[model samples]
Target chain A: MTDRWDLSTRLIEPAPDLLVAQPGRIVELAGMAGMGLTRIGYRMLSEASRRSPMAVVDVRGWASPAAAWEAGIDRDNLVIVRCAESSTWGQLVAALCEGVPTVYAEVPSAVRDRDLRRLAALIRARQVRVVLRPLRGELPGGIAHLRIRAVGVVWEGAEVGHGRLTHRRLVLEASGKGAAGMVRQIEVEDAGEDAVHVVSGVVSRASGRAG
Target chain B: MWFPAWSLGRPDAPAEGAVLVVDTKAGVVACSGVDSDVGPGMPRRQAEALCPDATVLIRDIGEEARRFEPVVCQVEELIPRVEVIEPGKLLIPVTGAVKYYGGEPEVVELLQGKMTAAGHDVRLGLADGPFAAEWAARIAEPGTPLVIEDTRRFLSTLDVGTLSGHDDIVSVFRWLGVTTLGSLADLPREAIASRFGAEGLDVHRLAHGQDRVVGPRPIPPELAVEATYEDPLESLDQLAFAAKATAARLMVGLHREGMSPFRVTTELEAADGTVRSRVWRSMSPFSESALADRVWWQARAWVDTGVIPGGVVRIRLDPSDLSGAGRQLGMFEDVMSQVEAERAFARAQAIVGPEAVLQAQPQGGRLPTEQVDWRQWGEPESKPERSTDDPWPGATPSPAPALIPPRPTRFEVEWEGGIPTRVRLGTRWEPVTTWAGPWRLTGRWWRDEESVDRYQIVTSAGAFLCTVGSDGTFLAGIYD
Candidate 1:
């Protein structure tokens, strides 16, 4: 005595988990410079590279490969491209989506709405995940599936002319189709010998998880 | 053949008597009319000190290739197939050309005469393989050809440093007392392979005068892809767009057969019934976008230089020297996905120039910017200038800045009681909430560069990495 609709629902694929980035979606990491946004993007790339190949389209030449290596990214699986011209950004990102499973790109200031739509369609068709970092400006509404903004950052283990910057605590607020109005706080620590990690206990508004 | 002083020998290079040095980001790449003390691979500052009167010029690779095109075209007239190793160096299989021209001497004489008449200094080398021939050309006097009857014997007399491009392996060989090519060749091939892996084996083979030879495979007729235009398009953009699709089709056909081409011949038909064909080569297999890029470069070079009049009718890509598809793929790597990614990267390179598409490799340096070496997408990785294993004192602490500005931007800083209290960003003044360092970094003191004090300052707005120097306080990077 099962419902016919329930039986048919089993045929369709379930929605992807919200904790991690979903395939075929544009995840936007929006924040000003020095607000821990880029570090978060690198962490995502490191995680993505563990499963599949990843790339970074560094539009402003802002990406620090040393920092990315410290963030635990697999260098062999990562490709970093530095692009400056805004005119070619759309075409380049679209081409990247064709091959790479995950792409973290710095968004240029003036991207046409048509290009975003075209990119969104391609993303869905190819099942590629794109993480967009718009430091200069914001993307148009309805383009991004998830948006994570760095609200605050606190540095520890450094004082006037004394200890070096050893650790940071970052608070992020994520809101989108997946986790609407969810806030999370995470701690990033610099372990000695070229290792940086997000140390445990990611306290989410809805549920606490290990990061 | 090798063009002596290739960079300085460019037609647009400075007049003959002037000492010239051509440098790139990696420092001095080529020089001419300078003493041996100021040779290639030396730091520019060091080179400049050695030759005080030398005129330094930045390397313009595109210009070098453009200027070398005529020479390649000239060579093609005498030999149907010629392989260009770089702008200043090329290789030709002399077997067919030598027989047709009666002998190796006749072939060399004809080529030298052709180049000399065209106002170019030329040197030729004849041997069994490219490796021996290149060395022969290097030692050959201008306007003369050097022929080696026994390539192995000739190679045996050379120094171990002749194994260029394998600096790390060569250094190891030098350390092991293998100072000559003869000593390296004497080592068992399997032993070299086991120690240094595939690249070491390659060097050993070269030392033995055995070049890695891949015979050109016969291409299936249906594998060749072509695009025909009804209305004769003349614009470069139109031709490039057409070429992209045609190149993709050729790649698909090759992929279906589990093969990829290391060389391709791009044929273009002009509206005036002129057909131009050029062979483009790559060290690695040509991806779809790479083949397309070569086609674009060829078409643009022809059209802009007026070599091909009224280019419009047809475009064709015929691939050769096909190798197994997964020959370059690493273990556990998904071949299809990796190939697709490379194709996309090459396409991106086409949109932006090749230099813009980069891959980063960690290297030794104190600063974040200097610690990573950025190489072009497909080129073999070069040895790091410095060794990371060496302890770098005064190096920036890790968790390096995420956003490093291409150039540090000047900022206004107000000091209070010998401490930076506030910094002006744009029109707003943000008070420093916390701060660290005045880590004094004196870089390359030998060059008389000023010392700079770097600080990590946190304000209510954000955190910044800034440097205080004689010039001014500048924002160097962001900790984002």
Candidate 2:
């Protein structure tokens, strides 16, 4: 069956390592600041805009232009809307329902439960993917379809003889229906000057794909 | 129209970070895709520190004009006459071409399509005069055209800061709490002239859209078309059917005159002689069908609201601000779609601020951060003075960092014989298994601006880019 989040095209192209959620599906990336959640979001947003015209409603102006550039979002194709107040969930809902293919928002954590429910309902009704990157706190229940929990860097590998921590192995735990109890090994390496490529290794199929 | 960051849109290596373009005499000549806090005329070092991932390039006057040649050439092909305000901005007079094109929107759409195909993206603005047109273009999103229907109302909403070439007048206006053009125009023209002199009056006239070209142009009397109904019309559908022929005839008259109107002032007269009218503006040339649609929508809204005192007996379509003829019906669908996409993006820009949309151009710099420059979309591209061909000594060797923190993250490093034995990535500390370099990248020690002892270290947890500067050891970039 086609995914409900498949309202249109996927924002970030699905990678062997990175799981690109379907349209309208909320994937919660639970990690600390340095765990690279923002990078994943940028990657997804950039890819989505490249495939189709998209917009970003930056609630707190959190989307970095530099990161967005690295993600390869064409400025011509992308529209960025910035709002300061958490009370602006109404605007966020409006944007979600708009015809734009993707609308990524950094929903502030201080937002009340009622607003979140309203936003969730809008997302469900519109059937459009709205990537919400909360700055803090766990994502409220009944919103996220998949949750990727960062388990920190598991191993730092040195270039055989080079002795520099050039390659790193990050441990991420996937929890959901099909992906539940599955542990995946992902590799992140500095691709020189300023590009980060996340290479995903084999999943130890403690379980099959999320049902 | 105003090209916001013209220099950064160069054909060379496209830069894609916060970019600051500077000249020796002017310091920061232009900036694009940067935060508002960073602006023109800022010193180089401070700008870099403020936006650490920013790329700083000296301005190249010769190359900028050289590259701009194609844009000028493309525009010249469409209108025969174009005034180059600067490298990134151009103005084309449409008074003579409107009749040929059928409408202002059509002409702009053609030019935009042609120029874009020719590899020069431009923003278009239509107004009574060059000053307002340029402002409209500047405010318009890149790759889109902004049509000004009411110059006075539009100008009134603009900040006085939009008045270029009158910095002194602007400063004084700020001091007087006169922020918008409307407020400034409210003051007596004589008072402004007596105090600020002829220059002030020039600015005042510009604000009011009464600039040098406003009243000089003469329009033919036969450009307008009207229809009279024998019986009063009570419904919108009937009113629209009656206006259809009139709209078509108006377009034909405009076409015969070798011009296309950008704005149409439609008037409806009721049987009781009560009249209602509204002016509609289109960014691209309006076809007969499109014009009819607009009229239908207008009449429907009015009739639905009971704004008409009685059934409509008369309808008039008056077209003005003509330009060259618009797109032929058989034009490629892809080209039209591209134009439509541009128009949509421009509408989005109206919702979001202008700075949200950005374009990237590459520039020569040693650091990865310095390699690319980002500028607001449709802004004038800045040319870099320093050639990328030059060997940038002491520049960080590639592959560049995947991520450059806006500010260097300070890290505590235990040094052993000048090599980091232990370091921190975030909260956790790990033993340094191996490492490389204490590459001494010391430069501008004379100015006390930057001096660094750079090293690449690998730990059990992750890799770190460690730099020891006057401040302390800090993490600069990440590899993975």
- What's each prediction's TM-score? 0.82, 0.47
lDDT of 1 at B24: 46
Please state the error at residue B144 of candidate 1 in Å.
3.8
- Highest lDDT among the candidates is held by which one? 1
RMSD of each: 7.8, 19.8
Global lDDT of each candidate: 0.75, 0.61
Best TM-score among the predictions, by candidate number: 1
lDDT of 1 at B3: 82
Q: Write down the C-alpha DockQ for each prediction.
A: 0.35, 0.07
- Across A1-211, the per-residue lDDT of candidate 1 in tens digits comes to 0121122222222112443567887788887787877767666556667666788899888787767777766777778888888898888899899988888899887888888888888988998878899856677778788777776667765677677676665556666665654444433443322333443434334433311
Cα deviation in Å at residue A12, candidate 2?
Answer: 20
Per-residue accuracy of model 2 over B1-480 as CA lDDT, tens digit each: 555566776555246667777764356667777778887767666677777876777776445644554566566667755554446767777887777788998988888788677666578789987768878887787788899999988999999988864677899999999999989888899999999876777778777878642233345887788788888888755875666667767766766554556568778888888886655555445666557666766666566556676788889887755643233332322332333333333444434545654444555665556665655543444544456778887666543444465555778888777656677655766677666666677666578659687776665444556678877888766542
